[model samples]
Target: MARVLIIGASKGIGLETVQRALAAGHTVRAFARTPVRLVGADTSRLEVVKGNALKTEDVEAALDRVDVVIQTLGIGLGDMLGPVQLFSKSTRVLLPAMEAKRVRRLIAVTGFGAGDSKSSISFLQYIPFRLVFGRAYDDKDIQEKLIKASSLDWTIARPGILTNGHRLGTYRVLTEPQDWHNGTISRADVADFLVQQITDRSHVRKTPVLVY
Candidate 1:
Protein backbone atom coordinates (compact mmCIF):
# COMPACT_ATOMS: atom_id res chain seq x y z
CA MET A 1 0.00 0.00 0.00
CA ALA A 2 1.12 3.54 -0.75
CA ARG A 3 1.84 6.10 1.96
CA VAL A 4 -0.57 8.87 1.01
CA LEU A 5 -0.56 12.46 2.19
CA ILE A 6 -3.86 14.25 1.81
CA ILE A 7 -3.83 18.00 2.31
CA GLY A 8 -7.02 19.58 3.64
CA ALA A 9 -8.42 16.32 4.94
CA SER A 10 -10.60 18.00 7.57
CA LYS A 11 -13.92 17.66 5.75
CA GLY A 12 -15.81 17.23 2.52
CA ILE A 13 -14.05 15.48 -0.35
CA GLY A 14 -10.73 15.37 1.47
CA LEU A 15 -12.21 13.55 4.44
CA GLU A 16 -13.92 11.03 2.20
CA THR A 17 -10.63 10.39 0.39
CA VAL A 18 -8.96 9.59 3.70
CA GLN A 19 -11.68 7.08 4.55
CA ARG A 20 -11.42 5.37 1.18
CA ALA A 21 -7.63 5.21 1.29
CA LEU A 22 -7.69 3.57 4.69
CA ALA A 23 -10.26 1.05 3.55
CA ALA A 24 -8.01 0.28 0.57
CA GLY A 25 -5.23 -0.61 3.03
CA HIS A 26 -3.03 2.40 2.27
CA THR A 27 -1.29 4.32 5.04
CA VAL A 28 -2.50 7.91 5.14
CA ARG A 29 -1.03 11.12 6.53
CA ALA A 30 -3.80 13.68 6.65
CA PHE A 31 -2.92 17.35 7.03
CA ALA A 32 -5.48 19.85 8.20
CA ARG A 33 -5.62 23.09 10.12
CA THR A 34 -7.63 21.39 12.83
CA PRO A 35 -6.65 17.93 14.05
CA VAL A 36 -9.14 17.42 16.85
CA ARG A 37 -12.04 16.69 14.53
CA LEU A 38 -10.07 13.77 13.09
CA VAL A 39 -10.17 12.08 16.48
CA GLY A 40 -12.81 9.76 15.11
CA ALA A 41 -10.59 8.77 12.18
CA ASP A 42 -9.10 5.30 11.85
CA THR A 43 -5.86 5.93 13.67
CA SER A 44 -4.58 2.42 13.00
CA ARG A 45 -3.34 3.54 9.57
CA LEU A 46 -3.73 7.30 9.61
CA GLU A 47 -1.53 10.17 10.73
CA VAL A 48 -3.24 13.53 11.18
CA VAL A 49 -0.99 16.57 10.98
CA LYS A 50 -2.30 19.97 11.98
CA GLY A 51 -0.99 22.88 9.89
CA ASN A 52 -1.88 25.55 7.38
CA ALA A 53 -1.43 24.69 3.71
CA LEU A 54 -0.43 28.28 3.06
CA LYS A 55 2.72 27.89 5.12
CA THR A 56 5.89 26.52 3.55
CA GLU A 57 7.42 25.08 6.69
CA ASP A 58 4.20 23.36 7.62
CA VAL A 59 3.83 21.76 4.18
CA GLU A 60 7.48 20.72 4.10
CA ALA A 61 7.24 19.04 7.48
CA ALA A 62 4.10 17.19 6.45
CA LEU A 63 5.60 15.97 3.16
CA ASP A 64 8.31 13.95 4.83
CA ARG A 65 8.33 10.36 3.55
CA VAL A 66 5.05 10.92 1.75
CA ASP A 67 4.61 8.66 -1.27
CA VAL A 68 1.87 10.70 -2.88
CA VAL A 69 0.31 14.11 -2.23
CA ILE A 70 -3.34 14.84 -2.95
CA GLN A 71 -4.62 18.37 -2.47
CA THR A 72 -8.31 19.25 -2.19
CA LEU A 73 -7.64 22.71 -0.82
CA GLY A 74 -10.04 25.27 -2.21
CA ILE A 75 -11.42 28.74 -1.52
CA GLY A 76 -15.05 29.63 -1.26
CA LEU A 77 -16.56 32.08 -3.76
CA GLY A 78 -15.97 34.88 -1.31
CA ASP A 79 -12.28 34.16 -0.76
CA MET A 80 -11.69 33.29 -4.38
CA LEU A 81 -12.87 36.62 -5.74
CA GLY A 82 -11.73 38.66 -2.75
CA PRO A 83 -8.00 38.68 -3.40
CA VAL A 84 -5.82 37.22 -6.17
CA GLN A 85 -3.33 36.24 -3.53
CA LEU A 86 -5.61 33.56 -2.10
CA PHE A 87 -5.04 30.87 -4.74
CA SER A 88 -1.49 31.54 -5.87
CA LYS A 89 -0.11 31.94 -2.37
CA SER A 90 -1.36 28.61 -1.07
CA THR A 91 -0.25 26.74 -4.19
CA ARG A 92 3.14 28.40 -4.08
CA VAL A 93 3.75 27.00 -0.63
CA LEU A 94 2.60 23.47 -1.34
CA LEU A 95 4.31 22.93 -4.70
CA PRO A 96 7.81 23.72 -3.55
CA ALA A 97 7.48 21.59 -0.46
CA MET A 98 6.50 18.57 -2.52
CA GLU A 99 9.38 19.16 -4.92
CA ALA A 100 11.91 19.50 -2.12
CA LYS A 101 10.72 16.34 -0.42
CA ARG A 102 10.91 14.42 -3.72
CA VAL A 103 7.19 13.64 -3.57
CA ARG A 104 6.47 13.39 -7.30
CA ARG A 105 2.91 12.19 -7.60
CA LEU A 106 0.55 15.12 -7.04
CA ILE A 107 -3.16 14.95 -7.55
CA ALA A 108 -4.98 18.26 -7.14
CA VAL A 109 -8.68 19.07 -7.45
CA THR A 110 -9.94 21.97 -9.58
CA GLY A 111 -13.33 22.62 -11.14
CA PHE A 112 -14.65 22.35 -14.71
CA GLY A 113 -14.61 26.09 -15.41
CA ALA A 114 -10.99 26.53 -14.44
CA GLY A 115 -8.74 25.63 -17.37
CA ASP A 116 -9.23 24.60 -20.98
CA SER A 117 -12.72 23.50 -20.02
CA LYS A 118 -13.94 27.09 -20.07
CA SER A 119 -15.19 26.81 -23.65
CA SER A 120 -16.80 23.48 -22.80
CA ILE A 121 -19.34 24.98 -20.38
CA SER A 122 -22.74 25.90 -21.76
CA PHE A 123 -23.70 29.54 -22.24
CA LEU A 124 -26.21 29.47 -19.41
CA GLN A 125 -23.67 28.10 -16.94
CA TYR A 126 -20.95 30.25 -18.42
CA ILE A 127 -22.87 33.46 -17.81
CA PRO A 128 -23.12 33.06 -14.05
CA PHE A 129 -19.55 31.81 -13.81
CA ARG A 130 -18.15 34.69 -15.82
CA LEU A 131 -20.07 37.28 -13.85
CA VAL A 132 -19.78 35.82 -10.35
CA PHE A 133 -16.92 33.31 -10.29
CA GLY A 134 -14.83 34.93 -12.98
CA ARG A 135 -12.00 36.00 -10.73
CA ALA A 136 -11.78 32.73 -8.88
CA TYR A 137 -11.70 30.77 -12.09
CA ASP A 138 -8.99 33.02 -13.38
CA ASP A 139 -6.81 32.30 -10.39
CA LYS A 140 -7.44 28.59 -10.58
CA ASP A 141 -6.36 28.67 -14.19
CA ILE A 142 -3.03 30.06 -13.08
CA GLN A 143 -2.76 27.38 -10.41
CA GLU A 144 -3.31 24.65 -12.97
CA LYS A 145 -0.65 26.13 -15.22
CA LEU A 146 1.84 26.10 -12.38
CA ILE A 147 1.15 22.47 -11.64
CA LYS A 148 1.53 21.52 -15.28
CA ALA A 149 4.87 23.26 -15.50
CA SER A 150 6.26 21.65 -12.37
CA SER A 151 8.48 18.60 -12.66
CA LEU A 152 6.18 16.64 -10.38
CA ASP A 153 4.05 13.92 -11.97
CA TRP A 154 0.65 15.59 -11.55
CA THR A 155 -2.97 14.96 -12.50
CA ILE A 156 -5.51 17.73 -11.99
CA ALA A 157 -8.99 16.24 -11.59
CA ARG A 158 -11.61 18.78 -12.63
CA PRO A 159 -15.08 17.78 -11.50
CA GLY A 160 -18.27 19.44 -12.52
CA ILE A 161 -20.47 20.84 -9.72
CA LEU A 162 -19.94 18.55 -6.76
CA THR A 163 -22.80 16.93 -4.86
CA ASN A 164 -23.38 15.04 -1.62
CA GLY A 165 -25.17 12.19 -3.33
CA HIS A 166 -24.37 8.53 -2.82
CA ARG A 167 -21.26 6.99 -4.33
CA LEU A 168 -22.67 4.84 -7.10
CA GLY A 169 -19.18 3.51 -7.87
CA THR A 170 -19.64 4.70 -11.45
CA TYR A 171 -18.71 7.96 -13.14
CA ARG A 172 -17.34 9.36 -16.41
CA VAL A 173 -13.70 10.35 -16.75
CA LEU A 174 -12.52 12.48 -19.67
CA THR A 175 -8.92 13.05 -20.59
CA GLU A 176 -9.57 15.71 -23.19
CA PRO A 177 -10.74 19.18 -22.12
CA GLN A 178 -14.53 19.18 -22.07
CA ASP A 179 -17.29 21.02 -20.31
CA TRP A 180 -19.37 19.07 -17.80
CA HIS A 181 -22.39 21.25 -18.72
CA ASN A 182 -23.64 21.71 -15.15
CA GLY A 183 -23.15 18.02 -14.54
CA THR A 184 -22.82 16.80 -10.98
CA ILE A 185 -20.93 13.98 -9.29
CA SER A 186 -21.08 12.82 -5.70
CA ARG A 187 -18.14 13.80 -3.50
CA ALA A 188 -17.74 10.17 -2.48
CA ASP A 189 -17.05 9.20 -6.07
CA VAL A 190 -14.47 11.93 -6.34
CA ALA A 191 -12.77 10.51 -3.27
CA ASP A 192 -12.78 7.05 -4.75
CA PHE A 193 -11.20 8.36 -7.94
CA LEU A 194 -8.47 10.20 -6.04
CA VAL A 195 -7.55 7.22 -3.87
CA GLN A 196 -7.57 4.95 -6.88
CA GLN A 197 -4.83 7.08 -8.44
CA ILE A 198 -2.39 6.11 -5.67
CA THR A 199 -1.96 2.54 -6.89
CA ASP A 200 -3.65 2.50 -10.27
CA ARG A 201 -1.65 5.36 -11.83
CA SER A 202 -3.56 4.94 -15.07
CA HIS A 203 -4.29 8.63 -15.49
CA VAL A 204 -0.83 9.89 -14.68
CA ARG A 205 0.13 13.31 -16.20
CA LYS A 206 -3.43 13.76 -17.42
CA THR A 207 -6.28 15.98 -16.27
CA PRO A 208 -9.42 13.85 -16.02
CA VAL A 209 -12.70 15.76 -16.03
CA LEU A 210 -15.16 13.75 -13.95
CA VAL A 211 -18.97 13.72 -13.83
CA TYR A 212 -21.76 11.32 -13.11
Candidate 2:
Protein backbone atom coordinates (compact mmCIF):
# COMPACT_ATOMS: atom_id res chain seq x y z
CA MET A 1 0.00 0.00 0.00
CA ALA A 2 1.20 3.52 -0.82
CA ARG A 3 1.54 6.31 1.71
CA VAL A 4 -1.02 8.96 0.67
CA LEU A 5 -1.18 12.60 1.77
CA ILE A 6 -4.58 14.32 1.54
CA ILE A 7 -4.20 18.12 1.78
CA GLY A 8 -7.74 19.00 2.99
CA ALA A 9 -8.90 16.09 5.07
CA SER A 10 -11.14 17.79 7.60
CA LYS A 11 -14.55 17.72 5.90
CA GLY A 12 -16.40 17.48 2.62
CA ILE A 13 -14.76 15.38 -0.08
CA GLY A 14 -11.42 15.51 1.76
CA LEU A 15 -12.87 13.77 4.83
CA GLU A 16 -14.60 11.22 2.65
CA THR A 17 -11.30 10.50 0.92
CA VAL A 18 -9.67 9.83 4.28
CA GLN A 19 -12.30 7.17 5.07
CA ARG A 20 -11.98 5.65 1.62
CA ALA A 21 -8.18 5.72 1.62
CA LEU A 22 -8.03 3.98 4.99
CA ALA A 23 -10.39 1.29 3.75
CA ALA A 24 -8.09 0.77 0.77
CA GLY A 25 -5.22 -0.03 3.18
CA HIS A 26 -3.12 2.99 2.28
CA THR A 27 -1.16 4.81 5.01
CA VAL A 28 -2.81 8.22 4.99
CA ARG A 29 -1.50 11.57 6.25
CA ALA A 30 -4.59 13.72 6.70
CA PHE A 31 -3.76 17.47 6.52
CA ALA A 32 -6.33 20.04 7.65
CA ARG A 33 -6.61 23.23 9.66
CA THR A 34 -9.53 21.86 11.69
CA PRO A 35 -9.65 18.81 13.94
CA VAL A 36 -10.30 15.50 12.15
CA ARG A 37 -12.35 12.71 13.65
CA LEU A 38 -12.59 9.43 11.75
CA VAL A 39 -15.11 6.91 13.00
CA GLY A 40 -13.96 3.27 13.36
CA ALA A 41 -10.63 3.81 11.64
CA ASP A 42 -7.20 2.34 12.40
CA THR A 43 -5.40 5.30 13.91
CA SER A 44 -1.96 3.70 13.45
CA ARG A 45 -2.12 4.03 9.70
CA LEU A 46 -3.73 7.45 9.67
CA GLU A 47 -1.75 10.55 10.61
CA VAL A 48 -3.79 13.70 11.22
CA VAL A 49 -1.66 16.80 10.67
CA LYS A 50 -3.36 20.05 11.69
CA GLY A 51 -2.06 22.85 9.50
CA ASN A 52 -3.16 25.20 6.75
CA ALA A 53 -2.19 24.40 3.18
CA LEU A 54 -1.30 28.03 2.48
CA LYS A 55 1.86 27.80 4.59
CA THR A 56 4.89 26.47 2.72
CA GLU A 57 6.46 24.89 5.81
CA ASP A 58 3.23 23.10 6.75
CA VAL A 59 2.80 21.76 3.20
CA GLU A 60 6.45 20.69 3.06
CA ALA A 61 6.24 18.94 6.41
CA ALA A 62 3.21 16.87 5.37
CA LEU A 63 5.02 15.44 2.35
CA ASP A 64 7.52 13.60 4.51
CA ARG A 65 7.61 9.77 3.94
CA VAL A 66 4.66 9.90 1.45
CA ASP A 67 4.45 8.16 -1.89
CA VAL A 68 1.41 9.83 -3.46
CA VAL A 69 -0.39 13.18 -2.93
CA ILE A 70 -4.15 13.70 -3.18
CA GLN A 71 -5.21 17.32 -2.76
CA THR A 72 -8.91 18.05 -1.96
CA LEU A 73 -8.48 21.72 -1.04
CA GLY A 74 -11.72 23.75 -0.95
CA ILE A 75 -12.99 27.21 0.00
CA GLY A 76 -16.37 28.32 1.36
CA LEU A 77 -19.16 29.42 -1.02
CA GLY A 78 -19.37 32.78 0.79
CA ASP A 79 -15.59 33.23 0.56
CA MET A 80 -15.73 32.44 -3.14
CA LEU A 81 -16.86 36.03 -3.77
CA GLY A 82 -13.71 37.28 -2.05
CA PRO A 83 -10.11 36.58 -3.04
CA VAL A 84 -9.79 32.78 -3.14
CA GLN A 85 -6.23 31.52 -3.55
CA LEU A 86 -6.38 28.19 -1.74
CA PHE A 87 -6.12 26.02 -4.83
CA SER A 88 -3.43 27.93 -6.68
CA LYS A 89 -1.38 28.96 -3.68
CA SER A 90 -1.48 25.48 -2.19
CA THR A 91 -0.38 23.99 -5.51
CA ARG A 92 2.54 26.39 -5.77
CA VAL A 93 3.85 25.21 -2.42
CA LEU A 94 2.89 21.54 -2.84
CA LEU A 95 4.50 21.00 -6.24
CA PRO A 96 7.93 22.02 -5.00
CA ALA A 97 7.56 19.99 -1.82
CA MET A 98 6.58 16.89 -3.80
CA GLU A 99 9.51 17.49 -6.11
CA ALA A 100 11.91 17.91 -3.20
CA LYS A 101 10.60 14.73 -1.60
CA ARG A 102 10.63 12.78 -4.91
CA VAL A 103 6.91 11.92 -4.74
CA ARG A 104 5.80 11.59 -8.33
CA ARG A 105 2.07 10.89 -8.25
CA LEU A 106 -0.59 13.57 -7.67
CA ILE A 107 -4.36 13.16 -7.93
CA ALA A 108 -5.91 16.59 -7.31
CA VAL A 109 -9.65 17.25 -6.91
CA THR A 110 -10.48 20.18 -9.12
CA GLY A 111 -14.22 20.28 -9.88
CA PHE A 112 -16.03 20.68 -13.18
CA GLY A 113 -16.34 24.16 -14.83
CA ALA A 114 -12.59 24.58 -14.28
CA GLY A 115 -10.36 25.06 -17.30
CA ASP A 116 -11.90 24.01 -20.64
CA SER A 117 -15.02 22.50 -19.08
CA LYS A 118 -16.73 25.92 -18.97
CA SER A 119 -17.74 25.46 -22.59
CA SER A 120 -19.47 22.24 -21.56
CA ILE A 121 -21.43 23.56 -18.52
CA SER A 122 -25.20 23.18 -18.93
CA PHE A 123 -27.38 26.24 -19.51
CA LEU A 124 -29.39 25.35 -16.41
CA GLN A 125 -26.27 25.58 -14.25
CA TYR A 126 -24.47 28.29 -16.24
CA ILE A 127 -25.87 31.29 -14.37
CA PRO A 128 -25.11 29.93 -10.90
CA PHE A 129 -21.69 28.72 -12.08
CA ARG A 130 -20.73 32.26 -13.09
CA LEU A 131 -22.51 34.21 -10.34
CA VAL A 132 -21.48 31.90 -7.50
CA PHE A 133 -18.41 29.87 -8.44
CA GLY A 134 -16.71 31.94 -11.14
CA ARG A 135 -13.81 33.29 -9.12
CA ALA A 136 -12.92 30.08 -7.32
CA TYR A 137 -13.10 28.10 -10.54
CA ASP A 138 -10.88 30.68 -12.23
CA ASP A 139 -8.21 29.96 -9.62
CA LYS A 140 -8.78 26.27 -10.21
CA ASP A 141 -7.88 26.95 -13.82
CA ILE A 142 -4.53 28.20 -12.57
CA GLN A 143 -4.30 25.15 -10.31
CA GLU A 144 -4.85 22.84 -13.27
CA LYS A 145 -2.29 24.66 -15.39
CA LEU A 146 0.38 24.42 -12.70
CA ILE A 147 -0.23 20.71 -12.22
CA LYS A 148 -0.16 20.11 -15.96
CA ALA A 149 3.16 21.92 -16.35
CA SER A 150 4.77 19.98 -13.50
CA SER A 151 6.83 16.80 -13.90
CA LEU A 152 4.78 14.65 -11.54
CA ASP A 153 2.64 11.77 -12.78
CA TRP A 154 -0.62 13.69 -12.32
CA THR A 155 -4.30 12.78 -12.80
CA ILE A 156 -6.61 15.75 -12.29
CA ALA A 157 -10.05 14.43 -11.28
CA ARG A 158 -12.50 17.17 -12.29
CA PRO A 159 -15.58 15.94 -10.48
CA GLY A 160 -18.99 17.52 -11.11
CA ILE A 161 -21.14 19.21 -8.44
CA LEU A 162 -20.74 17.05 -5.36
CA THR A 163 -23.46 15.78 -3.01
CA ASN A 164 -23.30 13.91 0.31
CA GLY A 165 -25.07 10.84 -1.03
CA HIS A 166 -23.93 7.23 -0.61
CA ARG A 167 -21.15 5.83 -2.74
CA LEU A 168 -22.63 4.42 -5.94
CA GLY A 169 -19.23 3.03 -7.08
CA THR A 170 -20.26 4.10 -10.58
CA TYR A 171 -19.50 7.30 -12.51
CA ARG A 172 -18.38 8.45 -15.96
CA VAL A 173 -14.98 10.05 -16.61
CA LEU A 174 -15.15 12.38 -19.59
CA THR A 175 -11.70 13.30 -20.91
CA GLU A 176 -12.68 15.44 -23.85
CA PRO A 177 -13.83 18.97 -23.03
CA GLN A 178 -16.92 18.75 -25.25
CA ASP A 179 -18.13 15.69 -23.37
CA TRP A 180 -17.62 17.30 -19.96
CA HIS A 181 -21.24 17.82 -18.95
CA ASN A 182 -22.42 19.12 -15.58
CA GLY A 183 -23.91 16.60 -13.13
CA THR A 184 -24.13 15.73 -9.43
CA ILE A 185 -21.95 13.03 -7.81
CA SER A 186 -21.53 11.83 -4.27
CA ARG A 187 -18.56 12.93 -2.17
CA ALA A 188 -17.91 9.28 -1.36
CA ASP A 189 -17.84 8.39 -5.05
CA VAL A 190 -15.37 11.15 -5.82
CA ALA A 191 -13.20 9.85 -3.00
CA ASP A 192 -13.59 6.37 -4.43
CA PHE A 193 -12.24 7.52 -7.78
CA LEU A 194 -9.38 9.42 -6.15
CA VAL A 195 -8.35 6.34 -4.17
CA GLN A 196 -8.65 4.15 -7.26
CA GLN A 197 -6.33 6.54 -9.11
CA ILE A 198 -3.65 5.92 -6.51
CA THR A 199 -2.87 2.58 -8.21
CA ASP A 200 -4.61 2.99 -11.56
CA ARG A 201 -2.33 4.50 -14.16
CA SER A 202 -4.87 4.82 -16.98
CA HIS A 203 -5.80 8.41 -16.21
CA VAL A 204 -2.29 9.77 -15.72
CA ARG A 205 -1.74 13.16 -17.43
CA LYS A 206 -5.49 13.24 -18.19
CA THR A 207 -8.10 15.59 -16.72
CA PRO A 208 -11.27 13.50 -16.73
CA VAL A 209 -14.62 15.15 -15.94
CA LEU A 210 -16.05 12.77 -13.33
CA VAL A 211 -19.85 12.46 -13.25
CA TYR A 212 -22.64 9.91 -12.90
TM-score to native of every candidate shown = 0.92, 0.97
Candidate 1: tens digits of C-alpha lDDT, residues 46-139: 8889998888889999999989999987656676556555566778888888888899999999888888888888877778888887887788
Give the CA lDDT, 0 to 100, for residue 48 in model 1. Answer: 86
Model 1 spans with C-alpha error above 4 angstroms: 36-41, 178-181
Model 1 vs. true fold: TM: 0.92
| Model 1 Cα RMSD, 1 decimal | 1.9
Highest TM-score model number:
2
